[model samples]
Target: MGLPAMAIVLLMALLQTGTAAAETRAFSKARDAITEPSHAQYEYIVVGGGTAGCAIAATLSEHYKVLLLERGGTPYGNPSIERLEGWADLLRDDPTESSERSPIQAFRSADGVHNRRARVLGGGSAINAGFYNRASDAEVRAAGWKPKSVQEAYEWVEERIASPASLGPWQKALKNGLVQAGVTPDNGLTYEHIQGTKLGHSIFDAQGRRHTAADLLFSANDELLTVLTFASAQRIIFNVSDENKQPRATGVEYTDSRNATHFAYLQDGFQNEVILSAGALGSPQLLLLSGIGSCEHLAEFNITCHVDLSAVGAEMVDNPINAIVLVSPNPLETSLISVAGITHEGVVIEGASGGNWTWQWPGMGQLNIFPPLERSVEMISLVQTNLQNLSSNTKEQIDQSGFILSKVYDPISSGTLRLKSRDVSQNPYVKFNYYTHPRDVETCIRGVKYLHKLLQTPAFQGFRYTTVTPIIALLYPELSSSEGERTDGAYIPDLKNRTETANWCRDTVTTIWHFHGGCVLGKVVDKRYRVFGVRSLRVVDGSTFTKSPGTNPQATVMMLGRYVGVRMLKDRKIAEETVNSRN
Candidate 1:
């Protein structure tokens, strides 16, 4: 049916929006590139002015000279990025060809699914839906962060960026619907990720203005901070220690927007370091380019081996999303993720409304769905044929639709990220084996079943149709082994059957853009986030996560930057005092 194609269309559209106008507003401490008479040495050189990068750089600059390099421009006047109403435009306006100046970079995974990453200074927070929630207690315990410090870090970020969400009419219905469906114990409004239906905070303010990690820089000591825009990091410069023979990251080689080369280095202090906060994809890709991955893999691209850390780009994971589209009887207002249903079964329920897209399905007819850019033409043709045969009345209802989707929360199935080319701008080959693990598939089935229960509730009864199989199960009716008869002589899946539900999950699985785990903690980096084989180098981004922290990762990623920055300051102070005592 066209529903599967339409669902994919909706998901992709939800993840992306249009490009922002290029407006450069000069920050007192920021520049387009390394200016002449640049500081020869920095106590910290942070590559990637993204969510974590911005936070960590701001924190470190409190007492140290910090250099933050962002591959894209500022978000100050970018309407598509700074205003929440511009969300659809920012994601829907896909570029015909890749450009280095775009705020959002699009890529296709080896799984043949389209995904996106942020190139702007604020990173994903500059482009995402602005959902904000703290990591669960279990996630904190697993990471072994002290509770008191973790709380302080979260509060610090919250005070600057996070705020209570403004629930619209549609969001209010979704909240009640989730509660009625037995998600249990409505916690009202809260930022903590607990097991229940709760209204979480958002990074978008009451006026629908987005506050990103870049805003955190306001707290930074401007005299000690220097942010460079349009600066792409090419590789790390390392020097082998004379005494220990261990490679220490000494500097970084990067190119400016004009293709001019520049290098930034660390100070002479033992604690001076270069940190990589380039997200999951960017971080690992940089490692491979710098020859920190498997020696054999690096040799294929003619890169000299540095650390031979085979785990640099291994075990990549992404949370798979399965959604059900609902055609509202009346036009609904547009909204992003707000109300949440965090279930005990490892499923997180969220919804949005008023998303509309129209496509000219090749050779079929004009349809109200736009497939992801990378979806094969052959598949599109097949979907078009099926959609053409649909009754005119059915097509009309689909044009006005919203979506209630569930994420796999913590997926177990993983894959790898390998270099497609040595160029840092080009996307690496990444394959997230979604639904490959039995448990992941089973968890998705549970989520769908839960969604089915919600649609059956009184709050959602207005959208339900008894004569046909539920709209939720319409995506992949043919894939299911068990069938339910529709009045129109169409066969739909009986989702009540476990086997059918499992098949539905596998057929329609897609990403929620929460991919992580390329450079995992304890494997590639130590618990302190420092690379195992190298000194004066560390990774402090989502790439260091083995599992995502909460319902969303943006808040946690920002918190981590602050948390690690504070820890680094404390470590340096202790070392200084110890030296002073000996003297």
Candidate 2:
């Protein structure tokens, strides 16, 4: 071909590529219709486009005009998120990539645990591993949740999301290992069964697509639902005219990515409700910024206290988790599994009754273990026995596939969120206080030890496995070698004399990212999810969870959003009827 002709062809190809990219970009930008001033006002305002906000906006838009405000920009729609097999790739990104974009400013614990969350649209769901597990009936009851209410909601969510439960061959191998360790299959703790095992089914749709709230809700109304991306809510505007001091939220003031200020008004001056669906950290921070939290804290900022509710930022709870990575003799391809209730004799241990200690594993099949706490000890013994039983080839398979055992201990250490500065632009001061409770630390240690025993079994004899324990060495180097001796001495210190070394590891600790409980039900929000002493203001998100479920919270958050959306619609209808009757 002639040089001129070749140059022309290349130019045409470049234009085609740019056009295709623009079309894809336009598709994503189209969802941000709410940011437009003309589209600002709505019957309802749902803040934070994470798990619950997406569902709430989708449900409310079906019946009423809705405006959804998300602080982060549109997702990149990376191939990793789209492919079902590459789900782990989402978790493989650098911690900074996740942290810098997160709505909450995360910090490392004194002992080296990093608390991180997603700030982007679809919230954590966009970045999470998509492990969906329902709350156990006993746990719900303990939290003053009605069994019938939760069951109905769980069933609705399951059917809507088409909860993934089938264990493929890879998942089965992991399940086999867990069973050999004495974890029996329990369906009740699974997402579908509610009292099943801790093992959850992978969240995949009928077309084998990963099922996420973003996919479910965004697909519902591409044209109608206006999602405002990169718009951060600074504060909520309340109607000062209400004689009863019942706050009628007028609108919200927010800042877009371009640093432009914008205001979204409510419809008809109708005083529609404002739903704070921002996750635990974001919700409380927004409330405190709006002068609705503890009067003392707000007073310090010289902001007039709107509601002097002390519980607004108290009672923060998160399930502390520790992971164990083992090299299997067999090439165990990675497949997600939920081992709901691990039992030895008859009693289930993880979620036991008495405050947060209650035992409940929803969704997995119910197989009662003998003597609750003893089950943990027995599980350790059984895992050791099973490792001995596995063939050398099986160990090799697991090593190649990157077999990892994840253990989530019910955290007894309760933390609180306090406002460090009233500045909306600055992140709040959050104290996770993780591992503060000796029991929580012990449970985590036991879980790690349990995993180590499994790796030492004869089944894994020929496999080369390593235990990465930076935090243990940093905090208690003395316990390092002794613990290493028991596990074949795989401890190796990768960092040396760096101030941020512990912080980096803490930031990297594999977290479920299931932050919940600040502004929790009964403590901060009422049973109906309405903020105490405030009207026309409700919170709908994982933050409102009275207690964080033992497993993933995406399913629960979505269900709550739907539940609150339905309630809001019903309330509007009742008001309309009352006005008509009076007329």
Candidate number achieving the greatest TM-score relative to the actual structure: 1
Residue 329 of model 1, lDDT score: 62
Instruction: Name the candidate that leads on lDDT.
Output: 1
| Model 1 ranges with Cα > 4 A deviation | 1-27, 34-39, 241-243, 356-374, 377-399, 463-493
- Candidate 2 per-residue lDDT over residues 1-583, each given as its tens digit: 0113222121111111000111122235224433466326677788888788887888788767777888775544544444444444443332234343443334332223344466667677665555677665566666665566566665666665555555544444444444445455544334542422355644555343555566446444544567877777989988777667666667888877666777877786344778899888889989988878888888888877888888887777666543333322234433344334343222222211011100111000011112122223233233223334444543333224223433344566667777778656555776666555756554544444444444444434444335424322322232354422334322211223232323222322333466576787887788778888776788988887766664566777877777777666777789888888999
Clash number for each model: 8, 69
TM-score of each: 0.88, 0.73
lDDT of 1: 0.78
Give Cα distance to truth, residue 393, candidate 1, Å: 13
Which regions of candidate 2 deviate over 4 angstroms? 1-30, 33-35, 84-111, 143-152, 163-170, 185-189, 192-199, 205-208, 218-224, 241-244, 269-271, 336-409, 422-425, 445-449, 456-510
TM-score, predicted candidate 1 vs. hidden true structure: 0.88
